[model samples]
Target: MEKTFKNLEIYKVKKAESVQEFYENLSLNRPGLTIPSLDTLYDVGHFNVFTRGNCGSTGPVSYNRKDYYKISLVIGEGILFYPDQQIVVDGPALLLTNPDVPYHWQAGSEAQSGYFCLFTENFIRNRNETLRETLFSRIKDHPVIHLSDAQATVFSEIFKKMMAEMDGEYIHKFDLLRNYIHLLTHEAVKICPVNEASKPTNASARLASQFIDLLERQFPIDSTDRVVELKTAHDFAAKLSVHVNHLNHAVKEVTGKTTSDHISRRIANEAIALLRYTEWNISEIGYCLGFEYPANFNIFFKKQTQSTPKAFRKV
Candidate 1:
């Protein structure tokens, strides 16, 4: 049954498409779709916005990730598919996507109209690291935000501003565009502020909090030059100046998950993201994840996800 799943449609994987490849496929699929010069796009770090005309579908889009981030003002109903869940939206909505997640959008009706913008991370770098981190962190956790008519109008106006800025030839247009991107992200946060569970007060909770923060600081794995260093409970325990058993007790007591469980889950998430978004071979990905042997990575991934990295990247 596991072997059969390799050929199953639901288990099939599509590698994330790059900006150039996205436009190439768009042109091939939607003939006569005029776009700005690709050269200009790269020179400006690749940013573009579009108004969805006549519903915006060459056909049903498949489940896949893109190499860029996207923010969309969805005006109609649709279903969004994640790895383990799906969300249905029946009205105006805001959709946020990052390079870390693979998803598919299926329209619920024929009448769909909205605006969306796609841009590389570097395009939005305004020296505000906090803003950049907040943007992608919120996007990865909550990709869909249902919108009210008033809120929809606000996002729509923002998109219009982005479109207008894109068409202009100002000397510092990219900087202006970055500001608009920040505006959209900040507005989204305002509309749907993530509710925080109260802060940790006890010593165990505080220690667990520190462990989680330290673990998360090594994430997303943007490049292969650096690899995850602390993989085992002992490693993290040593770093935190606690015994492995004590660390485990604190984390399990506070987060209801063992130190190993938290580490494994985070590493698994990064592995999946790297597998779906990168062209690196299975061995290289394994090495980047701190596996000295390909077989170890395969076993770990299979234990976490019930699928091999190669099998996960079917395409």
Candidate 2:
């Protein structure tokens, strides 16, 4: 799986954060930071836990995906922005996010505190198949479960146990940690069961949902060498093995937007994010976003936002 990730053209787009990059970003954002045995996290099947502040401030983040699975226990208030909706987590909450979902976390206040642990798929692979599917599958909605005080205490104690185990010298400690992760998932299931009821029921809704998922999978274009592969309605229709007209009708029926409209809007959003947050030159950004010419990207950006990419970036 790791080899597939490295070789896949889609993965080269750098839409998702790798574990190494996650720490590197930490070091860059928080100077003089020190985390013990950082080198060990590079290995496959790695797992680690940290207190919220120890990880870093829960500041606003660009909407993006992670290559690893993460479970966060958030106390106090914060806002989670997914592409489709915004969720305000107002109290103690258990948040689960997988590799397939892109989201942004915006801190509400300094009062927020809790624990979060992240691990690669290999970390729990082959050990418990049921637990793996239960926790890491695509969580469509309700990924954040608001917890009562007693429930929060129960999860808090589990995280405390994980922290204690990490500090201890017990051999096979990770095995125990994996069990804790499993326990956490089971406990969360008790609060909110993962079910298919959240999925779209009708045909048009399903096709539209699939189209949106496929579109979202290609986003936050972080690398200059890679470009979005599915750019046109025909491209998406072919990939989904449907007629272009059929796909277009379904999407319009369900989303109230044309196929080209969704594509262009998403591409424009990525263009803005790259222009705002990245240091890449205009041409590099253009090429990565599937515009072969810098002039073309400028035109598209202007058409979408009524401002040239250069001028937008300056502002």
Candidate 3:
């Protein structure tokens, strides 16, 4: 059996409390700066680097979905892992990790070195979601691209410039990182071909697939503009027009997990995303997630993740 991501001695890049926690391990967090909230459209996440043998991380990141979107320009040999795909490559490759996708990487060599910038949808929302939509459409499936040495240098320059911008005290520094991220993504589209996975072949598989999609449609909950109405397996079944037992059976048969399990896991993913990226108080966040009271959301989050919302946010 393939090892689950958490079942290995892998380096996990968990979420952070503030942007400073993101860079402090790199010896880069400036003292006396206030931590920013990721909840608002005006507030944006920042950039940082993760080098092998540093930050006590001995191996590559395990297969997982991050709460935020990431664009990593890896400069050494490594293997990229995904649920439906895996790619092993030589020197340089540009990789995108989306909140919706689960993936991991293991360095194939010790000389791993590169730059990666992490940002949220809020970061690009100010630009009117143009960059986010363009990059998403172009690279949603083909998130990795192998680059030649010279090509690597070109992308390298962009990331290097981002590092410099991050180090500088410009007020609009994050605004600038947004532009560099934009350029890096545009360059990736020019080099990679579109990749589409084949559709499922069986009825159980198709139903299970559709069920998963329906479950994920209500997510990130960036704001309280609307509330999630589907909070149970019955709700999802009703949406899919199937008996609860049938829905549960299809999901279990194809994914080896129950419908409730899928629902819970996706909810946990969204909870973590909001906790890490938003400034909404726990009650508002809970209401958005379909909980009627703050205490109930607290219990659910703690049960699903082994930590409370406040504690998880601090991590």
TM-scores of the candidates in the order shown: 0.59, 0.57, 0.56
lDDT of 2: 0.74
Candidate 2, residues 32-130: lDDT per residue as tens digits? 866545443322247888777632243234667776788899986776766566677778998887654676666666676899998875566441132
Off by over 4 Å in 3: 1-46, 49-62, 125-134, 195-233, 243-315
Scored by TM-score, the top model is 1
lDDT of 3 by residue, 5-52 (tens): 344454433332234444453344334544444334222333444333
Candidate that beats the other on TM-score, 1 or 2, i.e. the better one: 1
**Residue pairs with clashing backbones, model 2:** none
Q: What is the lDDT of residue 64 in candidate 1?
A: 74
lDDT by residue (tens digit), candidate 1, 1-315:
233122324432456777888778767746887766665332234788888654434343467767688888888776777655667888999888876457767666677788999987545633224223565455445788888999999999999998898789888887888888888888888877666423556888788878988887777677788799999999999999999899998987654457897788777767766776688888888888899999999999988767777777783
**Could you tell me the lDDT of residue 190 within candidate 3?**
76
Which candidate do you rate higher for TM-score, 1 or 3?
1
By TM-score, how accurate is candidate 2? 0.57
Q: lDDT for every model?
A: 0.74, 0.74, 0.67
Q: Which one wins by lDDT: 1 or 3?
A: 1
Per the 3 Å backbone cut-off, how many clashing residue pairs does candidate 3 have? 0
